[model samples]
Target: MRKRNTLRQGFACPERSTMTVHDAVHARRTIRKFTREAVPEALVKAWIDGARLSPCSANQQPLKYKLLMGDAAAPLLPFLRWAVMIAPQLEPKPEELPPAFVVIAVDTAIRAAGAEIDVGIAAQTIALLAEEQGVASALLSLRSREVPVRDALHLPEQMMPALAIALGHSAMEAEAVPYEDTHKYRLDEDGKLLVPKRSLSEVLL
Candidate 1:
């Protein structure tokens, strides 16, 4: 495979390699803190490509992507709400913000009301592909207030932003631990984020 190009200055190319789907699934985590290094544009495009190939409900394929990098990405940070369970603390500091973002939009003209399933699948596909490429990603959704993403990006009337994926090199590590009383994830003594997962025995019917 041909190597992807990175921005000449601050961007660093993610390490490319073949990773099993299982490995990518387990290795992927919701990264909130990120280094200053920018994610390569080519890698972002590849991730969107991965989402493009994801399954769609009734094959409507209404999903659209808006790629943002560097200064273009700054406008989006204010609209994203991070881990509510561990907010304020888990929120990325100004210096630790993701250098790239992919806004997942839905073309209402294609399949307006029933594209939630397709959105979920595409988001997960993007996340998994980013993990396989040695990049960190956080899938974020807007909170109570409406985000003016459409206006910011000049999206068509039919296209509406559904989710945003923050991307960059990770500044922190997170891991899944055994589920206890609550499903909420927490920070360990060492500051690592500990996400809880129910055992297979518990999840399997």
Candidate 2:
């Protein structure tokens, strides 16, 4: 019998050094401020590949993605509201705007009812994948500005813009803080984002 490569064989095992899904979930955070560095097309495609695999209701998948870069993404900034908790202070400055965006849309003609949940699943999947790729992201619901955004993207009658994900290298730090009295997330004096997270004990009940 021929000897096999132990390292290659063990790579698929969960005990390996590679980051696990759980690890990526914990490490993923909503980053508002991003560096000017652009996210490459290859990585964006890979992220979308992962998002496309997200579980959907009754397998009636109906999500669409529009990739925008640099100037293409700049127009979206005025429509997206970010870091509302800290408002202007934590908002992305002109120099710190994300270099790319992924506009998630729903094909209403397919299955319009449950598309919102699908959007969440796809957005979270992309965010997790982006985290693994050393990229940061912010998820925006573009609800109030949907009309204008839809016009700007020139979306077809059947396609409705649902979510917008800002992508780039992180320019600030965000950490999950223990949930105290308030559930609102805030920025510290050092401008670090403090996310409020409830303990497992409180949530398992």
Q: Rate the local accuracy (lDDT) of all candidates.
A: 0.83, 0.80
Q: Report model 1's TM-score to 2 decimal places.
A: 0.89
> Tens digit of lDDT per residue, candidate 2, span 1-205?
1111122332311112355678778988899888877677666776788899999988888998998988888667777878666788778778998888999988888976667889999999988777766778999878443567877887787788889999898999999989999988988889788999999999996
Query: Best by TM-score, which number?
Result: 1
Q: Give the poorly placed runs of model 2, Cα more than 4 Å off.
A: 1-17, 143-145
In candidate 2, how many Å is residue 182 off? 0.4
The alpha-carbon lDDT assigned to residue 9 of candidate 2 equals 34
- Shift in Å, residue 54, candidate 1: 0.8
111 in model 2: Cα distance from truth in Å? 1.5
Q: What is the per-residue lDDT of model 1 for residues 55-148, given as tens digits with 9 covering 90 to 100?
A: 9988889999999987887767677889888898899988988888999889988986878889899999989878777778999986521237
Clash totals for all models, in order? 0, 0
